[model samples]
Target: MEEKKMGLMKCLFVLFAGGVIFLLLLAIYPFWLLFAKVTNLIGVKGIRNTSGKLQTPVVFYEHSVTKRIVAFVAVIHIAEPAYYAAIQELIDSLKGYKILFEATGKLSPQEEQALTQKEKDISSQFDFIFDLMKKINELMSLQYQKDGLTYSASWINTDMRLYDLIRAFAQQDISLIKKGRDIDDPFTEEFGQTVARWFINKLFSRFIPVGVVLSVVAFFSRDKRVAKRLILDARNEIAFQGINEYLKDSDIVTIWGAAHLSGIEKCLKKSGFREVRREWFTAYTVRDYSLFDAIKKGMRATKEAASAATALKKD
Candidate 1:
């Protein structure tokens, strides 16, 4: 009976250990990401630039998403230095565009404030999985850094009311979105092979050394939540960004997650927009170092503490 009890205990230990490992693996990403964000607060001193370079890949001979010739820009959201730089460059590049329609879902502060206190609380909780995501998404938001950007939630999905958002997740209807398609649109096959290839490429890249490199790049990047925040919400504004712009402007620079590019392309082509050119940016490098960056932060912390102590002594 003692031996039987010992065997059961060992089995339980193994399961417990496995569960712990799984949980840690899931969390390791946010850990490194948080570390990067924290270090960024002090600046990347002694760090040999742990960021990815900007490259615009012109892999599509035609409009990658819409099959119509439309100008589209792709940014890797989960990658470092590359993500931050691409966003600013994209914004700055848009010098005199009369209309800038942002499909990336974000908070409208003044608009939300107009709501009643109860409505405000309900509204704030819509996009947030945790309170931390809400705060993080707001701070690290990119489009708001520049003027003339509008948050148009209904551009992608017309019925995105506050209550509709709350109920969609409860009904588990989000999963069925991709499974359904535009039954009215017959030109879907123009991108069929291309979309299939893109999916397979992404799948294989994640399993290979490339994926490992991407993981490292993601940590070094700031505002990782900004681009990724779209993934969690039931409404995907990224797909509609291109077409939404097409309705108002001839020249459009749509910055969205790389994975969402194809759909945006399809939407653009359906609206008669065309891609003019493409560019590629470097994402990761082994030459960059972060050890000294961490040390510099430590040193700064000590210096601040010492100064505080000196002030207290003088007092």
Candidate 2:
């Protein structure tokens, strides 16, 4: 009976795997057709090509909102050796200035207690995901630095904090995943690990790069209503610090995440600040390899985009 049961399990696994492969194969043609059509759009063409550099993805935009020029240096957080060094370098490079940082705000005692309970609840339901994120952040050095930054943090806004929204999203993700899962499934941890690995691999797949993901987020971020309000309050922080102090040569530098850059830039523009200088630096390394690989991929993508655009023009 045991042998028979084992055999039945093997057969079911094979059938499931085959079905998944078949669906993927069926998806390719439609995806290709869609990609072909999307290449013709004007702004999309610039993004699809090698116009951007291969770095950890940092932007240094100069804003003259105050009497002194303020440099809003936006960066995406990454947990890697080089990423840590790049952050330090950024801090070191901008000396003798009042630096305003994007800070996670203090939680009320009740909120803190609720968060603790949520952490416990999350561990019980999605231990694998929580543990993995924790490990990755630790490995990548992905936490805010107090001593390294050498500055007091300014809340992007007084009324809202980023962590509060993230907690809400965490609950939402938990609820969605739990509702979709089967009660009798025995491979809880293993299943979670498999899905996480597969999803990340798909993101880094040859056809769809991480840049494209960021571009999508950046595009939607233009709408303040749809995008998370956490980063949206960057304008508030700029105003709060900008109004607080000003000197003939004093510069207020804002070190925030790249995801918030576009929105922050838009807000700065509204406040009459113009971009005086811009520079890019690496923010995250997708692969644990040399930066050359990223550069080569960028070049290849640009070549492909250019060819696609030319073909569309001829048509």
Candidate 2, residues 192-305: lDDT per residue as tens digits? 333443344333322224455454665664332223443355444554444344424466666665545666566656666676665555433344433355445545766777
Candidate 1 lDDT over 146-264, as tens digits, reads 23223333223222344444333333322212223333232223233233333333332222234344646765654333323334333335336434645353444444435445555
Worst 10 residues of 2 by lDDT: 43-52
Q: Total clashes, candidate 2?
A: 8
Q: What overall lDDT, based on C-alpha atoms, would model 2 receive against the true structure?
A: 0.48
lDDT of each: 0.42, 0.48
TM-score, per-candidate, Cα-based: 0.38, 0.52
- How does residue 308 of candidate 1 score in lDDT? 89
